[model samples]
Target: MTAMQRLAGFVLVLGFCIIFLFKDGRSQGNLLTGKTVYVWDFATRDGEVNSLTGNFTEEFEEALIQTQQCIVIERRKHQRLFEQRQNEKGIMSLDEISNAEKESLKSLHTNIVVFGDIYDDTEAGQLRIGISVQSFEGEILTKTSVLMPRGKKLDAESRQMAMKELVQKLVSGKDPRPSSEPIVVEVENVRFELKSCKLSGGNLVCTVVITNQGEDRELHIYLPNTRIIDSDAEEYLVKAATIGASAGSAKLVSGVPVKAILTFGTVA
Candidate 1:
């Protein structure tokens, strides 16, 4: 065989080896796997209603177990480990849980932690529970909320339904919060200003100022109805809008300006 033919054969073999290694590395890097989850006790809004949170946590753990999507760590084992750390470090509260302590807990091979707050919605005559699930790296994976009829007697069936919904939402990777960020859209007789913007998790959050120049009138702005147009004529839909803590709708009165935070989820 000619020397050129041998050179060509060597190059072909080298190319095959490189391609095989690249494909192998890509597959190993992108493997999707189940995570080990640790569910902690939920805290009450008033800090006085312990039983409410306890019951909710119990139901939540049970629902998570039934999903068979995660390896749920036992509450007792988690409590013992937490208490051992607290005693050793003189930590008083989980809020005071340091990065070192977090790393130590990660050593247990638990990848996800779920915890939340239970609020007494007295006005609505219901109990509002807000739950957040985070990764061991402290990144919030999802937030969930459940409302149950408030009464002297706890509703077991309602609690079960709520827990099941939360678990299903988590496993499905759906966020209850609005997914779109707010951007200033140019409208006739209206002035739109962007004050600040930030990327939080998978959402773009922005603080904006809106001013109406016309006569005394009420201007209703639906954030989700708004669209962001790029230089390339690509339109991005706004998923959610909020003013202060209140979300969904915002009212702009004539001669009165309003500043509100808007969140937009990244285009999937």
Candidate 2:
């Protein structure tokens, strides 16, 4: 069939797909992979930078490097340059910098900036530190935090655990979200409710619940016409089928529900 036909067709006699139903058209790569990150020294509740502030910046950057996903931009050199320019312009922070200054800083390989804030919860006897990840385009991607005893910074193991949580949050934020409502397709008086699509034993398996909405009928299904097309336009044809109600037969009774599994062995 033509590309146009495939573009509009996910209806297989027993074939359907999970195309872009769960995606938002963004790059589907792991969140931090190759992303340029710039982490700042955390500001304490007193509005001052202390040793704890420096440790937050260093440890967080180290954790990001260990993942080997993002490109951690060295802040020292770029920060010195930024300071020198800011001094000459009599400005202090990013908020005071002009649009021209932001544009000029594009030479630095950077995508997101991490700003951290630490609060001393004396009553709770805990130190709460949160980091906000913001795109250079001014979008807040995520806000994550960890709490430790009020004494000082996190212990080695605690630091690792906290960093892992931060990484998990970043990765999950970029993943495709499930539909808010059920996805249903109707064809020839039959309704197909797409339950889920998953991979098993190296094959793509799509689970569907099929129901006859009209009178009992002969549902002639040409297997070759059934396939799964992904958002990348890659196609996987139906290789095997297991229909729970009729033992793979196509006869359908009105209002009868049948659960079926369509396997696409062409998956790689």
Q: For model 2, where is the 10-residue window of minimal lDDT?
A: 84-93
Which candidate's TM-score is highest? 1
Candidates in order have lDDT scores of 0.56, 0.60
Instruction: Spell out the clash pairs found in candidate 2.
Output: none
lDDT of 1 by residue, 1-268 (tens): 4555334323322232233223322222111137687776666643443666678888989998998866888776557556544223222123345666576567778777776667677898987666656555544444557567787328788888888987775666533222234334444455565555444543545566767676543333344445543222334455676653456434456767877665656421
lDDT of 2 by residue, 51-82 (tens): 66667667777777777777887766567545
Model 2 ranges with Cα > 4 A deviation: 1-29, 77-79, 84-104, 154-161, 172-268
The C-alpha TM-scores of every prediction are 0.49, 0.46
Best by lDDT: 2
Candidate 2 similarity to native, TM-score: 0.46
